[model samples]
Target: MKNWKRRESFLPVAVLLLLVSLIASACGSGANTNTAGGAEAANGSPSAAAGSSTSGADGKKEEKTEKTKVIWWHSMGGELGKAADQLVADFNASQDGIEVEAVYQGTYDESLNKMKASMDSKSGPSLIQVYEIGSRFMIDSGAITPVQDFIDQEGYDVSQLEENIASYYTFDGKQYSMPFNTSNPILYYNKDLFKAAGLDPDKAPATYGEVKQAAQTLAAKGTPASFAIYGWFMEQFFANQGAEYVNNGNGRSAPADASLVNGDAGIQTLEWWKEMVDSKAAINLGRKTDDTKKAFLAGQISMTLDSTASLRGIVDGAAGKFEVGTAFLPKPDGAEGGVVVGGASLWILNNKPEAEQKAAWEFIKFLAQPETQAKWHISTGYFPITKQAYDEQIVKENLDKYPQFQTAIDQLHASKPSQATQGAVMGVFPEARQIVEGAIEEVLGGSKPVKQALDAAAEAITGKISNYNKTVNVK
Candidate 1:
């Protein structure tokens, strides 16, 4: 009986041992399968991987490069911002191995301020879009890598770009940034109002003197002209008259230490503008271009001076109400000068990795393509930086649809390259502009004479420039 019990125990133990061996064998098989999957992944052909590899007809795996991500900080807002975002989306969808994130920080002033604060950290942008006036500050900041480096490396032909537009961003024979949105001030007038005032409907005024006459006629007919007392208009007037805004080649040849705001050209511009307001030929519409644009569209004003960037919006707003007309920025009669380029450019920052900056350059190149520029020009009223964009079919169609746009392109093309037209560059330009606007208000309110207001503005700007030079350690 004892022998039988031992035999039973032995049989149970043997069964248990067999079950453990089967489990071990199954686990080993699974281990081998997992190891094979890992090896396949290492060899760049893992089945679970997507977009990183694909099989060819030759049964070999083709590996894809990982995307180099970049961030673009821009100041574009409203409808323009939307258009910029769409371009980024299209770029991402059209390519692999590069992804861009565009973040709209704020307006030009606010965006620049934020960029300054973020310079010490890794939180800043790989690429930044800075306004024209900020060029001096950007160059002095030493936080940027000149796009010229990439241009030289790739032998990129920049002759295709608009010379006047590129000139604003060029310094010392190097293009510091890529011109994106470009514009110049232009005269926007209501053609229906012009006819009502007995002025030539198709013949817009092309000089300060002619504009004054038209304003008088329009005012007598119960629609006074309105020009926003914007400092940029002041700057444009100086350029249009072939007058420098500062000494030392309009702050291009060297750092400027004084202001030419009290020069003859400045006095002439201010006198004519103040006379129009005083004689009731033109109405003072404060400093916001938006307010003046609204007044013009509402038929309260017969004419206005605004950026060409406002062209599309102005035209669309006046649709079915009145015919809109555009003319080159008016200068003193017989002044042999042209308008300076307004708007902004794209700069690659040094805060990011070299790979990221190269990636940013790639994106900038994409933006500079004729098709992209054409779309941008059509969507926004800003000029296409590249001349080739004008050759695009959409651009041709757009010109046919909105003939007013032709004036901007014509104005840009007609401009002769000069130091004045290349625009004044000062580190304190935004502040200087504010002072100029304040002086304009003082003169318009009859609290100060034109000469006195402008002299005071010049003094103030000079002081600001001195302080800026000190901060930048520029002797």
Candidate 2:
């Protein structure tokens, strides 16, 4: 084991160490979008030339006699946060002219709010990590200096990045933000439960129909719940069915005025979820995804849908509980698309000192290094964003031990990269998802009809998007 020396951290050890108990909630890859559609791409300006650098506040390079300090604000907690801290230490030690300080700023939502506050106070971090859905908000805010500028200037060949992973972070043929922790959802089930239900332990369900059938079998055998129903998994289902979450290709080309999820895919999915809950085959664990995960770990539920990052936690949690297994997310009978990539990316803010921007760029490049990416993948359960990181020995060993991790790798490989898979690129996606979850609750609770619930969500989301675009002067 590589015993990395402890480094500096803004939070006390007790609070940060508490994250170790949090498990790999993998909420990072959870529903960050409306219908599992978030972590949108931002290619920025495709016309940007090589060796370009969106420079200092004055757009001019200035001299600095002292080492430039670059601040990186992030929301990763627990073990992932520790790994991030180690990464910063490694980079700081490897270079002399630049010092990178990583600040753990609570959750993703909190970090984003803090980042905005910092901007208001003229004290924003040079490098900020935002969740996938924050893509549009960050871009529309106009405070980010696309890292493409630094990549072009440094002539850094980003071809080594995993194409599928990069697809979600790229926009307008331009790379806006650098994708960091990327992952997709997968089906997690108990092998023992599968066998008990007379189902194939090795061949997990691949379609909603199959899942329903398996759930029936499991339930008949006294399995309380088969899977957890939430907006994220529904988002995966929509993508699988080649359904769009919003108009204008998930708001990539122009501002989205309405939601497309109110169509066939949406109705079919929610109806199926209602049947599951009604039949007692799937548990209505409410919106707290962690509770559903606990049910699965305790054998109260037979299967669950979650991000690949949560594999380690489930494995650890299921050690004395049951034999856990993984597979691609269950789709509709004949879906044509794939799941969107969830997880966060790194964005460099504009208008900072030229030296600070350059320093921040340097650290971003360092983090993208194959060695660094490998450490990140192994230490945390996030997928490696670079093609080369898979070749690392440590990564290989990690996967070999936890074969469930391979399910996400295969599923991502099989995914057809499209607008549906890239997720919604609207500025208000963060809020849009809340509306989606609420619709799920209303419809599933039997208080509102599926169509009515979804239509209401669509109306609310459209208003939010329209107002957001107007707020940012989109028109």
Candidate 3:
């Protein structure tokens, strides 16, 4: 009985250790990934030897290697997923050395959560797509080999990658992930509503104040409420106002100590927004972006703010309803800060074999190539992350057919980058955004004053930051 009891108690502890070991083996370093399979993956960069081993040591032509199957977990669905599937097929056909299989994970947040379990089992995919908001979490998890690591090892020149997109994904002066399917927030207005409201259809609102005026005019014209009450919009407004999202230079330098969001920028934006709702100039559409978008597509709303990636859907939805015009997101006080990149990126997982890593990197590079990006942008309406993609014939034809498409690209190029625009980097950002949205709801519902609601949210977020920092041991 004593021996049995001891074994039972020790079982859980042993299992926990095994799990930890598996996770560490999977993530700690891909530098040493050849303990099994009898085949040595390369040395140093793991894939280094395999990469250059197209020939043997005798200077004789080497035979073809076995196909390395690379698993790619992504959150894309619908049309985007179809495009991804086509690309994967194209990539597989292009090379006999690698076979990439694209698997659809849930949403971005769900992918992150599910990835943790797979990492613990040392069965994580070779590549995972992570959203921009998950940047800090992915870094702190240490489950990734930074893109710069592969770049330096392979001497890859990333000069073709757009700087505006790179400015967001880079951490500590090094690129962390390869930017993919990038987008920026822009204003989409109905020209028919504008004409009915006696406003110029050719010009767009350039500031928050103008948006309100346009909303008031549209509201008077029996147009649906203008704009969404989404948390992402709040973040954009703060950045455009040149307000710091958090301390420590929005966590670009060091971990953020506290949130600076409840100050002037937050108060002014939220207060005016509440006034808009109360005056019926705008309606509080709540948290879901799709609801706001649906209202606009149904012609219930005149104008809205959404990611440029949504342009294709909106265009399709408005086929015969009304003309859709897009412009840069209206700035608060017309400040100088630029906007951050939205959308996800390709992160190469560590603890994978060198051959697999090299294979995954090949696919990532192919995805970023100008021709591929041009095709992607034309199909999905997502801004091509590469500058050269804009020069492609397909992209140029798309731009000519839809002039509003160029608005987002021009806006990205014209604005100057700053700490505010680069966006806040925090492991707790997803939670913080939830809290902020809740606060906005309370203020709009008249349960709290704008400043008071924002202050309370900020204080709560500071506690979350401390806890998250503790969990990640980031100090």
Quote each prediction's TM-score. 0.87, 0.86, 0.86
How well does candidate 2 score on lDDT at residue 443?
A: 78
Query: Per-model C-alpha lDDT, please?
Result: 0.81, 0.75, 0.75
- Tens-digit lDDT string for candidate 1 (28-146): 21111101111111011111233568788999998866777777877776667778888888788778768888877766655666766666556888898887877877776667888
* Stretches of model 3 off by over 4 angstroms after superposition: 1-64
List candidate 2 stretches off by more than 4 Å.
1-65, 226-229
Ranked candidates (TM-score, high to low):
1, 3, 2
Clash totals for all models, in order?
Answer: 0, 7, 0
Per-residue CA lDDT of model 2 for 270-340, tens digit only, reads 88888888887876877756777878888888877877888898998899768899988877777788888
Which pairs, if any, clash in model 1? none
Better of 1 and 2 by lDDT: 1
Residue 432 deviation, candidate 1, in Å?
0.5
For lDDT, the strongest prediction is 1
lDDT at 475 for candidate 2?
A: 52
Candidate 3 local lDDT, 1-475, one digit each (tens): 0111111111233343332332232222111110011222121111113434366788897656557878888876666777777788778878777788887775665566677767756777899988777787677666677888889998987888888788788866889899887888899999988998899998988887888899999998887565555667788788878778898888887888587779888888887788888989988776666777888988888888888888877877898889998888887764777677778889988868777888899999999889999988987788888889989999989988888888888988875788788888876776677678778889998999998999998998788777666554454
